[model samples]
Target: MPSSAPVAAYPTSTRPVSIPGRKPRTQGLRNMELAFLVFAYVIVLAALLQVQLGVMGEFDFQLITVFGFLVALTVAMHLVLRFRAPQADPFLLPIATAINGLGISMIYRLDLVNPDITDGSVPNATAQMVFTGLGIGVGIAVLIALRNHRILQRYTYIFGAVSLVLLVLPLVPGLGVSEANARVWISVGPFNFQPGEIAKITLAIFFAGYLVTARESLSVVSRKFLGLRLPRMRDLGPILIVWAFCMGVLVFQRDLGTSLLYFGLFLVMIFVATGRLSWVLIGLALFVAGGTVAALNMEYVRKRIEGWINPFDPDFYEASGGSYQLVQGLFGMSNGGLVGTGLGQGRPDITPLAESDFIISALGEELGLAGLFAILAMYFILVSRALRIGHLGGDDFGRLLATGLGFVIGLQVFIVVGGVTRVIPLTGLTTPFLAAGGSSLVANWIIIALLLRLSDTIPNQATTRLEVTT
Candidate 1:
């Protein structure tokens, strides 16, 4: 069914012409992604097999079947991206998959130690697998439904309102469910969801859209302080409002992690939009003052600081609401040493909330410092790619959004990992893709979809410019 025709293009005028035989570079990029995904999945499968062998002393087909289903879902997502977002960043999905896979395997390993687990009570690993599929499905839905990230800019305030509502929903008396000293959850039938997780994304969107329009005013220099150009006092309204809101969350909601995350996200995005270092300094000062006051006044907050400062103290270690969990997590990581005890060899489950809040320590106890480094390296690559997307983006909104997204992930990793390593006071922030919270997983996958969409537009925007010139 071949027609005899010229494969080459000839330009008769000053306009550039497309060749009939030419292929878009996006196809090549997608091919590279496919190859990378293959390698990533192979590593995941190998890890799962090692866990099975180490824990059960025999290969179990159940986890393998779950892994197969996960692979199918991810492959389906990859295919969708091929047609929908071929020019998207290739590394995001693979890195997310590898981290999520490791989390699932570790959770499964921990489940093996639970002899009391019954068929009626679904294991954490199985629940995590189901949630992973749901997250991917939501991601695909986002890609299909949200064709352009710019459309979100149209409803900036609407998103801001939604974020506020979501943030306060956990504080509603009848609906709120407090756990682990923080009121950050709400029960929906059989599940407890953290609305703040989704709120983080919405807040990022709001910050990006608002900053794109307000950056000019925000950039107005009032005076110099400490050799830094500061914004006008009037411009300080925005940061002050956000800072107060964050402090309110800390005081009322009793959730330090979410409060810090929201403030940090806004500060980073605003600073990026205005190219202002003074904003960073001022924001840091405001948060430090707020935290200090809270630490001095609040009992729970004071105890957390004390726990971080001296977890081994006999008085604090043996108290009812003491440093027992933190100390145990440290001991577990100490057991890991240079290299891990291997996947299933270490007693990671001995640490409280090993598969959730203290996942990094659990992973460290089994995978060692080297394995942790490898994981952190993947996180570094992922965050760097997001920042690169922001830098290369053609539009202001895209740039700010991408930057905010990168900071959200980067700051979260820093907080969680720093807390685990005793470098900072611990807070309840899930490790993006590697934690066992369905709300966090769904929100993060949606973030990936947004990043993919933004990256896809970079090439399309370039082609549009070229076409306009031609």
Candidate 2:
């Protein structure tokens, strides 16, 4: 009996296993990365200032302060990202920092040319810098907190509604400040906000979400016409409505850049999601027709066309009432030639809004063709990265979102660069990260963050599947 009892005892069960959450020790490394970023920024800023002081004989301490503050803000953003979304793509925050730093440097350079903000005072580069910091802060906060694009997709409609409200708000009596060209900038205290920038992001989300939901139906071939496959006639209505609405916005708001951006984005998304070349052809035909009609009916559009054809022809310039801005831009770019006059040594002051629409010209004057191509390369990298993210994304919405965003970057760069070079009619669109606008900078940072989040999710999804299989 004693021997049987000794043999029958079972091993005691082990205590339940506990897995620890991955602590963000990488936060220290992130801080080091941010420190390197700030260091690079300081080097660039110092180089710029040295050049300016050598040529112009003076430097502004206010501008230095602004740079310092912006650097501080960027460091803060990195810390926030480490604390919140430690496992997120590390490249994103540094890329954002570089972009923002570049923008600030450009703005500071412009401030040198137009230092008088209010009757002999140094222009408030500090203010722009502050906004840049704020934009970076908001971008990091959104990316860290949102954590997933699904949540954004879930509320796409609501975001669209809010964006639409913001877009139309300028139409209200007192809120919108209408310039001579018909852009409605709302001035709040000292800050001017362009709702169109915000609208672009919201509309892209809505378009991506809507397209993902409707992809299969839209892809269905109802018939063919002239060797071109066509979608069901019912399916065409939604796209048509979107196109018409965009046209209305163009006609009413005089926002040619926004209108073109929206239409192009929609067409590209439709083509990509459906993988149909026929849709692209149909969209192209519709675009041609609409453009022709716009040119004929809209005085402003007609002017743009005439300006594009021959900016220097006196008769065309007079009839189209082409302003001095584009002319100055051409002059600045031409003065630079192949190598440029060198930073701080060129006459970029002649170009109106040299910090915004014509910043490329300024960059050309200062940094030469090499610098211009470098900026273009950055845009190309950004677009390629977004497309890669789209391709690797696990879900239709994420793919569409990434693609739509890539399309946006492509279109904006084309429009702005073409406008500056006089290859197309001047559309007053900022050159994304390099332009001096609060709304544009902020909106673009958010775009970068979303793309990074999407990039992060792709790997995580793949890893999860592999783990499940194992």
Candidate 3:
């Protein structure tokens, strides 16, 4: 037998195992980071209050209670989010909480100005507080239970069908509420439900599921003409049909904003997934044509266009006129030019639906231009983060879901802020997270939950895919 070669002893040194290409996951507490940010926000708000109320001598207990409650609820949400979704982006939840808190504060301030406007109510901050609690609870439940975004893909058609049913449900007899120039709400007992809010999320999921499977085919099956790549006419049939159907919904429901939102969101996701610009151009042309037609035919649409063009028209002040709300919104915003007239000082009562569509105007009036910019910056950051997460996600479904959700938020914010500022025709769309509607609140919270799920999967997604393949 040949003698075994002497084994060579290799020296070993202890060091953390580092993946060659991938970065190590950070262990910072995302929830704690969010809590600290929120705490800082409260401090800024308190400082503002100190300057306004302490200096001007207009402080009230109601304002203090509202701010205090918002801070408390934010802390509670942070606690719930800590254990539920530890890997979620630290900024999303805190930004959402800040927006919600600001909305409640604005609403409470408005209530103090004209008590009768709130229907003889003291303040509905408590109701919003309750809803925030419920929304956060639902968010945690979704994060804990769903486990993955792909699970939602299994029910894509079901969600779509249900969402469609809910969207059309308001058209049923004795169910819909025709308010704010649209019949989009369903009355269920004392609480009213906006089915469109739910519809947006469900349709988004369906869009993501469908697009992921078809992206490659759509990209390759294109006709090249004039040095531009366009999807084949046959391949475009489904998207066109969906667009027409959405247009029909807009025409019938008198909801141009949602129609624009859904159509734009669809086009964006498709373009991003397929890297196609032709679809975007086609969608824009269609939107422009549809907008012109609507402006010509619909009185409400025409009035909105005119209002945007000339909000300061004398005729707008007539009791039953188009510019009444817009003019009032302008006044409120102008009143809060720089640092705001203080939270409870500005006349937010001038604007109708100040707590919903025109909440930004109220914020501008009370919090000033600085506050308005801060709010917009928050939205920009949120959208940017969502997009970053989409790019980082390993799977097509996660990427599309996050992209679609981000598109929804960005588009909604643009539409609403533009409407309030009279930069575009007004449409009754609520601001995400900041608007005072239960459906909107719940929908946004669910969005946050989905993002958390996507973020959590990002680190291990590659290994999971490899394991499955092996």
Q: What's the TM-score of each model vs. the native?
A: 0.94, 0.86, 0.87
User: Could you give candidate 2's per-residue lDDT for residues 323-385 as a string of tens digits?
Assistant: 567888888988888888876788887787887888888888777887778778767877877
**Cα lDDT computed for each candidate against the true fold:** 0.89, 0.75, 0.77
Highest TM-score against the true fold, candidate: 1
**Residue pairs in clash, model 1:** 340-368
Cα lDDT over the full model 3: 0.77
The C-alpha local distance difference test score for the whole of candidate 2 amounts to 0.75
Error of 3 at 305 (Å): 1.1
Model 1 clash tally, residue pairs = 1
Q: Runs in model 1 with CA error above 4 Å?
A: 1-23, 459-470
| lDDT by residue (tens digit), candidate 3, 209-273 | 88888887788745687877988887877678778867877888888898988898899898988
Clashing pairs in 3: none
Task: Report model 1's TM-score to 2 decimal places.
Answer: 0.94
